[model samples]
Target: MENEVNTAGRPGSFRFIHAADLHIDSPLRGLSRYAGAPVERLRNATRRALENLVDLALAERVQFVLLAGDLYDRDWPDFHTGLFFREQMVRLGRADIAVFIVQGNHDAQGTITRELPLPAHVKVFSSRSAETVHLAALGVAIHGRSFPQREVPEDFVPQYPDALPGQFNIGMLHTSLTGAAGHDTYAPTDIATLKTRGYDYWALGHVHARAVECESPRVVFPGNLQGRHANETGPKGCELVTQSGGQMEARFVPLDVVRWHQLTVALDGVESLAQATQTISVALAEAVVGAGDRLHALRVHLTGRTPLHTTEAQQPGTLEAAVHAAAQDVAGAELWIEQVHLQLASPIDRARLAQGDDAVAELLRLVDELAADPAALVAWSSKACGDVLHKLPAEAKAETDWSDLQALRELLADAEATLLARLGGAV
Candidate 1:
């Protein structure tokens, strides 16, 4: 058994797995099509992670499993996705582990018309309104409501039924909870409002980063079962919750088969590319220690002021190749560089350029201004791309969103760096 607290005199004492944002069969985004990339392995990552969750539950022999939401992606691409989920459900059913699920924005009712019959062990909450499922033998009551549509703009807290008297209450909610960065505000509610519901634990979803919002009532987000992109870095998994003696204990158990990491390596005073490569190898070695045997999809950010800045910026592809070589050399575990970023500072002194009010200084000032203002950067990109973007193929246009402020900023930064390198005599 994973853990069990003695509750000899207590009425409610049980353990359950609380997990959310499974995103089963969801494709990993932003994968490179370059040679030697682990595209196939990444494609099947979600399924592997889901299997791990089931294995953990069986090994621990939990009474029940609480899947807060997002069991499926936005919609099923085909019936295979549904079949895979059903197969897993059958596995859990055979073990007598009941699964309580609530539909989040991604898997809201009507999102996917294709459906396969799930095992009897799974109890999906209603999308029309909040409802409760009482586990009579365990003295547990689970309250939840699924998203009727893709977006839930109103608060549904008041609709949840009151907790059953003398029962362990759990609220399975797929909410953004007031607000969370990089996630749409769905089924929004505040921590204060959740606490008012009198539930012993709130299993939250929608936020892909695991967070423990409260200890008393134990409001928690177990994060996504797997990290689909670089932005969703670090350990991703579910929460193993144990309730005994009126106290709730939640522990994060990482179930992701592959981990995404964003590592930063400082290159201060580095004079040559060889030294820089050595530095990256050392960082990769350290990262490998933490990754254990899991596959690592790393996005390395090379930062700091260095004399090799011009070379790195000018030949980013070459530098990336070197980093990839180093990763291959030192990686004790499977590691792949999703991308390598050069955020190196220019060796040229801005103050010295400003002292001479020349064209170079004015150009630098203009670039700085555009970089600072996202709107200006977007306008500049629109003008620069003008006729060329329109002439491009429909597929190319669809792939690139020039209107995105962040994308425009990155493009402008790269252009500025290239221009600065030429003017500063680095070329």
Candidate 2:
């Protein structure tokens, strides 16, 4: 619990919670993107995470909660999901913590969530135009706008009130703000424009990475409360905002229930299965350091060329089982080994394989070459299969892999580690 000061030079703190990208019904993307992960937990983690956020708001004694946008995934299965969301809102309302939100592209008018009756304390900004909600009691004025139909490329910040008289003006927005990586450029607004709006704090959304973009008048992305995939690593949560004596301060609070996990173990010249399995076990333990004692689920990626690859490739199922067994060895462990990606290669020299005339070798070479090509690489992915034709009841089948984000991140980390270790002579 830290003191929050407003810019007006007032005394005593006004505490509030800032959260965004709840995506209430977001289908756990990565867990089911393949097989082996705890499917039920993955599917339901979003709901649990939202509950966690509610708990956080109450614990922090926040007078209000700001939901920047995308409260639920568009067209969430049925009314039950919406009902569950309302239940959490009810808890916040009981605590007298009002919530303010704006719609994002995910839950636009065309989606199924357009009919939910949010709690009385929750206020959704007008989608047709910018509006302001003056909280005179708290000496705060919140200004914001929502997406009318979904696709809004125009900057929406310009429409916000320049500044409110005798109140801590907060601008709540759901935007891609100046083009964010891994996010669509929706409702783009420049940093300078947002700064000039004269709001004491600018709460932003659409990017899963938590950031403090500015300090003079704090602009922040609280990030998603839950991690949906391995790409969204590290702590995830909402930002707690409080203003005291006219100074406003915001702090990030972690709230993820079932964390999306990533564990990488490199094999340089290992040849024995026992040695490799032991190394993997140690790596998994290290990664789970701060995860606490929970029903942990992991996505393990076995990288770097190793002599174990030939055996690992021939019996993928066996390797997967072995890793699961190792994870299960931990006491009271409910850990599930989701998938073990074998990016390993044999210690045997590539020149030997190229020189050989084995038909399997030649086919492997051709397949590898195709995998290296940009267009061809995408065509070979499962996403491409769904894109080439129509599949009923799964409209999102055409979603582009765009970049194999997890793979790219792992590759880059490996490259950096190699260069650093070599340059410093520490390898």
Who wins the TM-score comparison? Answer: 1
lDDT of each prediction vs. the true structure? 0.83, 0.73
Q: What are the TM-scores, per candidate, against the unseen true structure?
A: 0.89, 0.81
Model 1 residue-pair collision total: 0
Q: How close is candidate 2 to the true structure, as a TM-score?
A: 0.81
Candidate 1: stretches off by over 4 Å: 1-10, 29-32, 245-247, 313-316, 357-396, 404-413, 416-427
What digit string (tens of lDDT, one per residue) describes model 1 on residues 316-426?
576687789889778468888887887777666866774567777777688778888878888898898789898976766777888788767767767767776676563
Q: Give the per-residue Cα lDDT of candidate 2 at 278.
A: 81
**Residue by residue across 214-292, what tens digits does model 2's lDDT show?**
7767888988888777778767788887787767666777787766577877878777878777887777777777665
What's the TM for model 1? 0.89
lDDT of 1 at 85: 83
